[model samples]
Target: MGDIERALQTFHSMRVSAIMPPIFSMPIVAEDSPIVDVLKLLKTRHHVWVVNNKDEMRLEGLIRYMDVMNVLLPPEHTKARLGNISSLFKSILGGAEKASDVMERNVLVIEEDATVLDALKKMKRYKVQILAIVDENGRLVGEVSLRMLIDEFLRLMKLGGAQWTQHGSSSRSESH
Candidate 1:
C-alpha cells in the first residue's frame, strides 16, 4: 500500500491520547488570573486553558492568541463592533481584569478516549486548530493540535519507507 494510505490506517487505529501532550505541559491559568498573564502565556503558546483552580483544574474557558489580539484591538477590527465601542474603551482602559473577562467560554473539547479521526472531524467542524482534551468529569487532561497530527503523519510516512520530493508527491521503496 501507498504511504499515505498506510498513514491513514495508522491514524484510524490510534486514539487522540496517543499523540496529545500531557496536561502539565499545556499552558493553564486560573479563571481569575489577570489578563496580562493570559497574554504573556499566549505569547509563548498557541493557546491557554482557563481553569477553576490549579488543583482541580476543571476547564472553564480558553484563550487563543487571536482571542487576546481581538480583545486588545479596536472594536472595529472584530466582528462584534456594532455596539462595542464601550467595550473597546473599557478593555483599553484596564476594565478587563481577569482571564474570564476576555476568554471564550464555549471552548471546543474532545475526550481523551476519542479516536484521532474523531478529533480531526471535530476540529474541522469547528474550524479550530486545537482542542482541549478532557476526562470523564470534564477535568483538563491534555491537548491536541493540527501540528501534532501533521507531525505524526509525517513520521508514519517516513517509517513506511515513503519519500517525498519537492513537488510533494510521495514514493514507496521497493526494497521489501
Candidate 2:
C-alpha cells in the first residue's frame, strides 16, 4: 500500500497508550494551594493537576495556565512584578483564593484503550490541547496531547512527501 494509506491505517490504530506522556512526572499540586504559589509552579508549564491534598493525591481538577492568566493578570500586565500580581487578582477573585477556586472541574478525558480518532474527537469537542487518560476505574493514568498526535502525523506525512518529491511520484507499489 502507499505511504499515505499506510499512514492512515497506522493513525487509526494508534492507542492513547502509544503516545501518552508518562504519568509519574506530571506536575501536581494540592487543591488548596495558594494562587500565587500555583502561578509560580505554572510559570514554566501550561497546566498543573490539582489533587485533593498532598497526601491523598485524589484527582480534583486541573488548573490551566489560562485560568491563572485570567485570574492573576490582564494580558497587558504580562511583565508585572510578582508583588503586584497577587493584589491584582485578590480583589477580583473575592474570597476564593486557592487552586480549587479556579480549577477546571470538568476536565475532558479519554480511556487509555481509546484510539487516536477518539482522542481527536474529544480534543475538538473540548477545545483542549491535552486530554487526560483514565483507566476503567476512572483514575488518571497519563495524558495525550495535541502536539504529540500532530507531530506523529506530520512525521508520517513528511516521509511520504519527501519520497514523492525526490521520485516525482509515490514510493508506493502499483497496487496501492
Across 74-172, the per-residue lDDT of candidate 1 in tens digits comes to 655545568654345325344677888777788999999999899889999989999999999999999989999999887888788888778766687
Identify the leading candidate in terms of TM-score: 1
For model 1, the superposed segments whose C-alpha errors exceed 4 Å read 73-94, 165-170, 174-176
lDDT of 2 by residue, 80-147 (tens): 47664433443224445788876777788788899998898888887888878877766677788888
Residue pairs clashing, model 2: none
lDDT (CA) per prediction? 0.82, 0.73
Estimate the lDDT of model 1. Answer: 0.82
C-alpha lDDT (0 to 100) for residue 83 of candidate 2? 60
List the candidate 2 regions with Cα displacement exceeding 4 Å. Answer: 53-57, 73-93, 155-176
